[model samples]
Target chain A: MRKDRVLNMLDNAEDNIVERLSVPALTDNEKERLLKMSMSKLEGMSMNINAEEEVRGVDVYRRPRWHRFVSVAAAIALVSGAVGTGFLLKRSGKKPEDSFHAVVSPEQTTELTTADTVSTDVTTELATENTVIPGTSETTADYQAIAVDLMKAMNAAELASSGMLNTDANSPLASDSNYFKIVDGNIKGFDFSTMENVRNFLTDNFSGKFYEQHSYFIEGSDPFFKEGPDGLYARYTGRGSIYGWDKYEPEIISSSEDSFVARAEYEIAGTTFQVDMTIVKSEDKWRVDSATSTLSDPDANNTNNSNPYVSLCKSKIEDKWNELTNESDNVSLDFVFNDLDGDGSPEFFLMYGNGEYNYQIDAYTYKDGALKAIGNLPGSHTSFAVDTSSRKLVLIHAHMGAGDYSWYTMENDALKVIKNEEFEYQEWGSNEATSRQDINYLSKGCIYKIGDGTVSYTQPECPINEIPRSNEINSFTLDIVDQLYASAAE
Target chain B: MTGNEYRRLYAESPEKAYAALFKVYCDYVYAIVYNKLNRVAQREDIDECVSDIFADIFFSYKRNGEDYADLKAYIGTIAKRHAINSYRSLKLRSERFSGDSDEEFASFADDTDIETNSDDRETRSILISKINELGEPDSTIILQKYYYDRSSGEIAEMMSMKASAVRMRAARALEKLKKSLAAAGIML
Candidate 1:
């Protein structure tokens, strides 16, 4: 009880403490400067709502997305047929090819140049003024670096010390979110007695389960490092009913000479939360040992919890295949393609659909002339497009209500995904509804990588495209996105 | 607090948010934003970030975002995140990561010490001292937040964090900071 009191006091520290830090009013010039920029930004954003039209001759979303290795096509019919062809077609317009690319423009102004100049970054004047001390440029760099290292050390320590961290204590709904470690693996040097027994022990004591073995495929060029052991290990975090809302905290795993802990941060009900974990040296390699956790605010008030509806939705997504039992205005679908090798044939992709009605993405392989379920990924409704780069098999997907689309790279046989970038614009809902609703759909599209410098995708104008307007959206975001991705990928 | 509570505070009590900023910081909001901006960054971005500093403070409090624990820590994270986001948009952008050459500035990922002795305060002190030697807002706040346990929003309200972070600036700032410091022959 005493400990709880102290912790609670700390949680509500602001309520009891006197205010710190002083206030500075915005200067008149500052106010005006801010207003002008806001207006310009708003104007620019509005201009982009219908900006990306498929490059006139360029084709997008015509090939497999998560398989960049597909350089060899049985009939790689170039959307432009040739690079210059697409370029020439779009070049006839007033906008340059640059508009088709998402290159950050030079006209963009910044504050770092408080010295009175425009730039893409904030003005250099602002950057300079923002310095810790008058000339803390060098010092500031050092400052942030130290902070990063410390956090890493702390994170490492937390991993080593507790092995796992729980995101919510009130709801004891556990999973591998807070903790994932090699509870078991087929290490080459060590016998089953040295490690398998320990693994067996964990399997018996905790709610242990085997995870899909994601063997590390480290390249000589990759930056991430992994030490110890052979084969692969499966891990998961545990959840407990300590708090009102479900929280998955890190779980510890004991290894022979070393320890490895794992935790997952997740978006629960629209907020991000994480579990803590640690791993330490065992007699041989590292193995996980323990976990600690903190609860999130969303779990505070439990009477209105919507787990049943949310869970029903989530479970449908996790399943590899499920028939559409019913339908409503909330139905949405997205496609996901995965290529095991750089070569394109026999690749697998799924149709992931979700929304207010019933969310399901039916993935089928075209074997025996009938499409059969292969996989599924559920979050919200999804929108899909493809990117065929020599380096990666990329799929750009936007889950419903997600401000940004995520990038999933199909390397080896696994689908490695990460949130990529965000773009402006939303579509208004125009589907059948017992109740009227506003939609922000941008999925009315397909992407085609026509050539090295040209690509295109279609984004519907939503209500405008469906109602009164007779034509489909004739815009392409690829010109902008391709430019951005090209630069970033480089 | 609820999101509604946060919205209400942001609307009617924007000054309350600003007041919170004042409480957490002395006059650093402008200083932090100034530290990261180029002339190209418009006032709107800075102002939005400034206003958001407060919103993040309150919402983050309600959210209890833990990548950082204290207000100072949160602000520094926010400011850096915003700055980096803005930098990507800048035309004449100089490589911010180019000049950092300290070893203590190295990241923990590069560090071999997986088993940290959390019980040893001396060990923590060595780390803290190494951080102190690094100096600057990043140093001041990263330590106060990550090492000391602070939140990015609290840091924002204090004018310590930059605006424009989708999530807290990649939680790797401390690791990077430590690597730089260590390279400078400072071992905390």
Candidate 2:
């Protein structure tokens, strides 16, 4: 055994003995100092918690009210059977190709007829080749055709309502004073005169089973419709918006006598996903039974072909890597991509460090079609981990016995600190000293030893366990970075 | 404080609750931190650790939504775990700067045998009992001088005595303790 080991054992034994004996008391000054420190920290944490709660409250209540308006507009457009394409184009100030149009203009209707004839010709050719069932082919074709028409109707309704649905400004529905009413500068409730319109809209498009499952327009479940003495009035429930797809091109995946399933490529907000629509024949008319959407492919949405900013950001990071590696052989550069701001576009965190102590994190995000540096944090030892609960990055700056933990969030296209906690060594002194009194008759030859006036020392105070366990970014080879970018581009 | 009392206090006023909690547990937490870190860390480090423990306790109560049935046990557990982590971190850092190998540090962390641990505990118990027999300021002088590694002058200041007197008492106490241990068939 090493001599140090035996000494360590003795030290441990002494500590155990002292603990068993009695606990030492802190001076009143020390107690007061610690209490003050603790209370200050508590206050800071409380502020952070309150801020988070406020943000969540806004997300839950404020944003959903706008979506409710859009839902009502879509229902109204569907029942009225009016294509507001021209109005939508005028309101959005967007060209036809920039937005989605389910129903083409009168000029394009002739072209659509020719395309439909071609589609019929192709089906006939396939049936002649015995690719489809002999007797059920016609019925299958009819179901598929009906499914496509219904999908188009749904899409047209969404497109028509998109123009009139304004969360920030007064909706056009508010102008129809007979059917709607406004209160407190918001579209608060619908007039009782609109009850018949609401009933007809719900009865026309949805099946009984759909109503049972969704309860979307019901009085009790949705809280959107309430019965009063006069009639049914609308209530504004703060349930957030449901997004509508820009386009859905459907193909029949399966067919039966009473029902058909159509899988469609649903595009929305510059991203493409898949949705399965179930159409069933009810009361001699086909209606949408249910539609389930699949998760979008992130790679498909983030590809260089789709987003030019991705490649730009990748190139910028590569240039930085080369510059860093050129400076020192022992330097390391690593990066991880995350959509910290929930804006669909991912921001990259680049960790640059020397082999020993010096480290830094440089955050870059694509803004205005170019890679822009958002923030950089430098320290002797700096690392970042994701706080999954709050969805923020916790940047840790640690050194020997002192460090800072800063919670970072992307706000207004820049990285900002939400909370910061610091721990460091503290030095304190006690001036308590023992005093001796000389007797008046004491001889001059007598001598006495004096006490040390003060005792002081520095001690490390680290709250390692207080930090949340988070997923930390680990460095990999530059080749892996290249591979990541290449795969994303592909 | 009990968990119900704390919750009630927190509901009434969070600031006052935090103050009450700190006042109750500050000394207990400081003792644990100081005991764990005294050999390796400085006074400020211990102070900071104590404050951090209280802060963590308050934060956890507010944010984690855990109904701590035994608040004292909860506080003690947090204090002990945090202090241990701080100790390991400081020790590892000290070893790194002192040019020690990783293997040496690993052994230092893991090499305590059961037999050796039991023997050490028994011997320390006996040593402490015999030292107590030395009585009064002598036992304190000895403990402060040898166990705490304090200087004679500091021990004198603490005991309200002359430095020379503290040193003399510490020496005599050690001699007496050594004789008592020998009579019990134990060697220091």
Q: Which model scores highest in lDDT?
A: 2
Model 1, residue B161: displacement in angstroms? 18
lDDT of 1 by residue, A93-204 (tens): 2221122121111221121112121221222323453434333222232222322222233332212111122111111112321111222221111112223443443332
Model 1 misplaced stretches (Cα beyond 4 Å): A1-336, A339-490, B1-39, B42-44, B49-138, B141-188
**TM-score (second chain) of model 2:** 0.62
Query: How good is the docking of model 1, as DockQ?
Result: 0.02
Off by over 4 Å in 2: A1-22, A50-490, B1-24, B61-69, B91-116, B131-145, B150-171, B181-188
Which candidate number would show the highest TM-score if scored against the true structure? 2
- What lDDT does model 1 reach? 0.29
lDDT of 2 by residue, A1-490 (tens): 3222211333433334645433224545557888888878767866765464434333222212222122223322221221121122122233323222222333333443344344455345444544343444445455555655555544433322233211111122332211222111111021112446445444555565544333433444333433444444333222221223333235678877667787766433234446677887668777778665543464553434444665665565566555644543333344555566866666677654323123345677778887877765442244444454554456544333333456677877777778755433210000011000110100000000011111111101111221111111112212223323333222
* Model 2 docking category: incorrect
Listed models, DockQ each = 0.02, 0.09
